[model samples]
Target chain A: MKHLTTKDLMTAGIFSALYFLAIGLVTFICMFTLPVLGNFLLPAVAALTTGSIYFLLLKQVPKFGAITIFSLVMGTFLLLSGHFPLAIIANLGFSGLADWFTYRTTFQTKHKSLLGYILFSYGLTGPLLPLWFMKQQYIDNLTSRGKTATYISGMFQYVTPTFFILLMFFILIGAILGGIYGQKLVAKHFGQTSSKQISDLYD
Target chain B: MINIQIKCLLLFITHIFLFIPFHPVQQTVLVGLLLSILFLEKERKRSLLYGSIYLVLLGILIALPYFKSFLGHSFGQLAMVFLLLYPCFLAGSLLIRTSLLSDWILLLKKCRLPMYLILPITVMFRFIPHFKEDFKHTFRLQKMRVPHSSLFKRLERTLIVLLHAAIQSSQELTMAALAKGINQLETRPVSKLTSLTFLDYLVATSSLGLIVWRSFL
Candidate 1:
């Protein structure tokens, strides 16, 4: 396996920042505009928006550790921004899996990389894990904010098991749509240069 | 006064405090304390901005029950979250504004972190600002082209252009770093002073004290 050069690392940093910012902007907008629904919309919207950035990163640096490094940076950022530590663990786990799926693959067979992207998209769910596992903490937070008991209950009413499963399903669908869209956009816009680069790498 | 490590420690401590549930008043006090630290660092503008934002959000949160509407509740919930995250935000702002990238690099190197982690972090700090500029330029260029284009088409084109720009910029940055012999550098000399002073110890001790008191309460 070819090691990541300084150039590759630098590219990773650029795209990772782009990817992080894209997701954050989309989520922030969704949060203010849609409120509770934003939580549901987050996974799908992020997947759709950031898919192109992820696909571009893969095409640019089809190396072993790039995705993992991206995940590490994101996880550390989330951790620093006051998320539960478990979120970071989940994020790293999914991204490591993503890295494995695309390991040593050429861009010609990019579906594996698409699968990797889907797994990467699933990492968005990590930050929300505490809402289920640590409900009381959230409840206490809501209560301490002087939210009425009904408001607190109403907030969590959507967090049913069925909704959780549906969320996973939506994530999968979103990833599929986003991944395909990203591949198409990348092929249309960045295809020529990246293909030449990939050919050079493999040849 | 404080070193980069101490600043990072304060950030970590503050974020951890955010995770644990606390009274709204207590959280406000903690955020205020962190904001005062920002003021001590001479970040008056940002401190004032954050302080006002906190106050506004607090006002909305307190007035939420009176409105008794979905939108009000939504805003209330959002306000509560922002209020909760205020300290972390303040700490992050303090850290980013007060410290230099070279200082971070020096501290990371001093701790003997791996090269992989160090390089990307440095590049990330540098490129975030660069990407913002790139996005603005790309959006303007998109606006200048095909004024009659559909919104979706224009957005799609803009994202494509931005990706291409990101690639070009990353290539240029990598070349620049290579030209600077970044890989060969043993230690980068920080332009700014980073020595720990009495203030560092005082802040560190107080941060620890706050954490302990909060946790035990």
Candidate 2:
């Protein structure tokens, strides 16, 4: 296994911030759009933004544990926020698994890398899974607040495991599309020149 | 204002207990923290105003569904989670804003963590400002497109260029830090300002007691 250089570590840190910025932007935009559709739309949009930026970032620094470290940091921040933090473990698990596949290619091939990214993106949806598992708590909170059964039912549609799984599937599809699109963006604009630049970044 | 170490401990236990159905204790901690923050009044005016707006919104959410059955379902559900998360979010913001990255680095070092782990985290803190500045240029790069290129091509090129500049800046930063001996753990001064006080112990004891009381399930 090739050890990551100091430069690799630094670049990974920068990309971590970059990924968060993109995700935060998407969250704000989706949050402000409309209520129900916004909640449904958030995952798909987040998958695209984070996935593409992550691919571009991975291209810049092709190392083994980059995904692991980045996901861990993001997860830590999530945990600190007192939200559904178990997703951090989910992220670490999936990203570590993806890193295994990427190591098979030694972070060389784009298709294999994209495959890893798609698997890795599943972790982003992990935080939202509480809506399914914590259904009773969520419903109780709403019901206590005088939310009607019909209103609760509307909310329930979005919280169902079936619906959550569907959203995850949609996110998976977006990540796949975004990964392919990111590669194309690279090939079209920067191409071989950036590969040399990427190598230079390692120094 | 709490010290960093206790704040960390408070954050940890609070985060853990917050999820495990400790309504009475949780609400007290959350409301206390929220009010203290609001009273501090740095962003107090906004907090006050937003507080009213949020309450009104919550009321609207609870009431709106009774009248318009079709519209309230998903929105009410979403609002419930939002309200539940709001206080915790405020507490988190307070902890994060109060705690510096260097403070975390020192705490990690005191815990006998490695240089490799510490370096990346510190550099992550360092990079936030640069990323914020460069993020603005991404839009500018989009507007300053190639004359003959189509819109899609210009957009693609902008992403490539923006990332290129970012990666380059990171490389430069690493080199600068490296030259300054950032890789040497001995060189960076870890603050000895903190020792676990009574509050830290109290926080730990409370969390452990709570966990045991809940039967550790």
Candidate 3:
């Protein structure tokens, strides 16, 4: 595989920053809105937020390792941000999967990029792993601490295995929608920018 | 002087410690460390910002027992929300805020990283400031376009110009780095990691001990 240049790598960094910023925004909004909507809708919103950055990055530089690098950086930061290893590892793994999609095949067009983005979206479920794997342990931890039975059972709406499965499905739908939205923005805005840059270079 | 390799290792190990299962005591230790680091940095403005965050998180964690009655099921959830990020919040922020890209590359070299990985990271680091400059130009040109009261139109134009400018700069940046023969170097200069300091030893020992404790103890 051809190596990435300084600019290509920098672009990835910038996009990585931008992508995580979107994630922060999505997470914040979800947290505030949690009172209105249950925690169930979070995976979907989180998935959609990833779309803009993936689309823009793919459109600008569809290089082989871009997605992988972005994913690694993002996962690293997420772990640093106090996320669990299970989810962070899952994010990297899914991102690796997304990288395979682009690297194994050409990623020059919207459709190819969208496919990669969709695969990458599966990683958004990383945040949900705590609920998935720790449901029993978490409940036990709370219960042993003297939390009431009613309180522990009340969490069923969100922490149940069924809800977790549905959350993944919702995440998939949100990611697909995000991909479409990002592609549309690219077609509208970025298509105009490509030619403009050539003119700027000449001047 | 402390070694970049150690710094990188410490940073990574610290992050892993944040992930230890059944780790409340360690998390509390990390939170204390984070607060100390922030205060040591002494950026007055950021002090309030990060300080408030830690305080709020501390409050939530402390209030867990008291709030459990009212917050009910959500109390556990909310307490968890705070608990999860308690350890790494300061560490991640400090690492990103404190280190430069060159520092990371130097550490990578010290670790004997491949040129393929090194080349991109160096460039990615260079990209942020360069893009920031490019965006400023786009914003300026956008302002010129909105000579009158056409604020909305100007905003749209500015955004378009910004995207064009971003794409253009990225291409230019690639060409420049490539032309500099970033990838052609056969070997990187060997890095000498000097002695670890007291603070470094403390971090290393504590993190190592914590890992062992979390894993097997």
Write one digit per residue (lDDT tens) for candidate 2, span B19-58.
Answer: 6554434444454555455445365765666467567655
Instruction: Give the runs in model 1 whose Cα sits over 4 Å from its true position.
Output: A28-36, A81-86, A104-108, A142-155, A192-203, B64-75, B110-112, B185-193
- All candidates' TM-scores? 0.86, 0.81, 0.74
The iRMS of the candidates, in order, is 3.8, 3.2, 4.2
Highest-DockQ candidate: 2
True contacts kept of each: 0.45, 0.47, 0.24
Model 2 TM-score relative to the real fold? 0.81
lDDT per residue for candidate 1 within B1-217, as digits (tens), equals 4688888887888768766877776777677777888888888888888889989988887776675666565556556656666777777777777877788788667778677767777777776777777767776787788877786686677777778777877777777888888854466444656678898888889888887777676
Error of 2 at B196 (Å): 7.3
Across residues A7-30, which tens digit of lDDT does each residue of candidate 1 receive?
888888888778776776787888
- Proportion of true contacts reproduced by candidate 3: 0.24
Superior candidate under TM-score, 1 versus 2: 1
Encode model 2's per-residue lDDT on A1-203: one tens digit a residue.
22777777777777777777667767777878764676676767776756556776677667788778777767766666555667787888988888878866565687788889887887776766677777777766655455579766766764556766688788888888877887776666556786676655564
Name the weakest run of 10 consecutive residues (lDDT summed) in model 2 chain A: A138-147
Runs in model 3 lying further than 4 Å from the true structure = A1-7, A28-43, A46-52, A80-83, A102-112, A136-157, A192-203, B1-26, B43-52, B62-72, B111-116, B122-162, B179-194, B206-217
